[model samples]
Target: MAPPAGPGATAAPDAAMRALSSFRRRRLAMRGAAPPAWLISLATVTIALVAWIAATQAGLVKPLFLPRPGSVIGAFSNALDGRIDGAPLLDHVLASLMRVVAAFVLAALVGIPVGLATGLNPTLRAALDPFIEFYRPLPPLAYLPLVIIWFGIGETSKILLIFLACFAPVALAARAGVSAASVDQVNAARALGASRVQVVRHVVLPAALPDILVGLRIGMGVGWTTLVAAEMVAASTGIGQMVLNASNFLRTDIVVMGILLIGALAGAFEFGMRRLERRLTPWKGKV
Candidate 1:
């Protein structure tokens, strides 16, 4: 039989076992660690671009269905020189951007307050909820004719269509965000002699900010999607208009170019909103 170990002898072994366990854990953690998100995104984009080039070169897909990247670039150059439908790319971009930005700003200005009022006052919520909910699920195209009849096929109708598209999501997000603040926090604010307005301004708004930002992001996406439909209202100049014209003429390369431009713009907006969210709601996931 082995001799009994002393207390000091066991302590050394225990220390070694702990060191071995820690080393194993660290090795496992290192092996399981994911690569940086940006690297993964880059790799994904690179692979997609390579696949697209290879597919086009291999004639697996016709140029009509998927134009070569060089053809799309040529279309882009033509757009810049006002050769594609005789309007410069800047003109189309600005028209669409102005309409989208205007509608989004208006929606945010109006929706946030209405959402707050409905969230705080049951009477207001009861009165408005049915109307909002009734129309919320309806697609913008369903009411396009009505909008044109009421407002005419002009800028007003176009902006209004996009506004209506953006409003519901922002309002609902703000309403839902109102519940994020704890009862304890509200009570604490009230107990400290904060007025109703003060409590809301300080506590409620901050708590709901994350959700509001999220809503804005969602609303912006909806606005972009609605842009094409909105610009369809007798529009002569806009990215959507350009794409529509290209489609009509079977200018698939121009169509592809316009699509890529719109996607790039929307992606930029998404990236901006994400940065803003991180800046404003640093404590978002921490809690």
Candidate 2:
């Protein structure tokens, strides 16, 4: 209804939009590039370390609260040599790893099948959905006391805590993966003389594996974080206990070292899971 814009006005707006679009494209490209990922990660760690060093040297933060990097290194050395708590750090790491392995393996065995069944059967889902939904949102700390009271302060209790923390994620992930299976593929398998069980085993499971792996990763993370709370029950020889013990004495360095060790272990698990996912689900998203 109005007069047409002048060439000059249209050109300026068009140029500005083009520039913005180009900038966005470049940013996205940079993010998607693998080389930049490592570079940025390294740069981020370097910046954090430098800032921490600066803060410590400038005495902006007390050593008792946040020890220097060198102090943490020394604490790590002591832990390795069995000088801290008169136990080798590897012993603590192994103890924690054992609990995680036990809980995670059990969760996978039970949760995966239950998840797959629920995905295939609406009746089963209706029956079990409320139970999973009710507890999934609750944190480990919320139910930890009840668990300890029921099971007593023992290894069983600790493992059970970790199990509870890991179960919901793995089950939900497997179920979601099942849902993601192509209906066409399922029907084709049925038409090709595949039984219900065979169709699920061959078609649905393979299709859902990528999602199941993702759920396992999340479950592992939850289990790892729940370690601290789990070890709170009559614990003596795990990273969580080590951190808690050091905190009692204001041993900030040891606490920080323990935290780093936990982070490293968790990161290692995540990396390994990602590799396993790629290898096991080569056909992911291809269908």
Point to the candidate with the largest TM-score: 1
Worst 10 residues of 2 by lDDT: 30-39
Residue 256's C-alpha lDDT in candidate 1? 89
CA RMSD (A), model 2: 5.1
Model 2 segments more than 4 A misplaced = 1-35, 285-287
Clashes of each: 0, 0
lDDT of 1 by residue, 1-287 (tens): 99898899989989999999999999989967978888999999999999999999999999999999989999999999999878899999999999999999999999998888788889999999999999999999999999999999989999999999999999999998899988999999999999999999999999999999999999999999999899886998999999988898888999989888999999999999999999999999999
**Per-residue lDDT of 53 in model 2:** 99
* Model 1 global lDDT (CA atoms, 0 to 1): 0.94
TM-score of each: 0.90, 0.87
Candidate 2 pairs with clashing backbones:
none
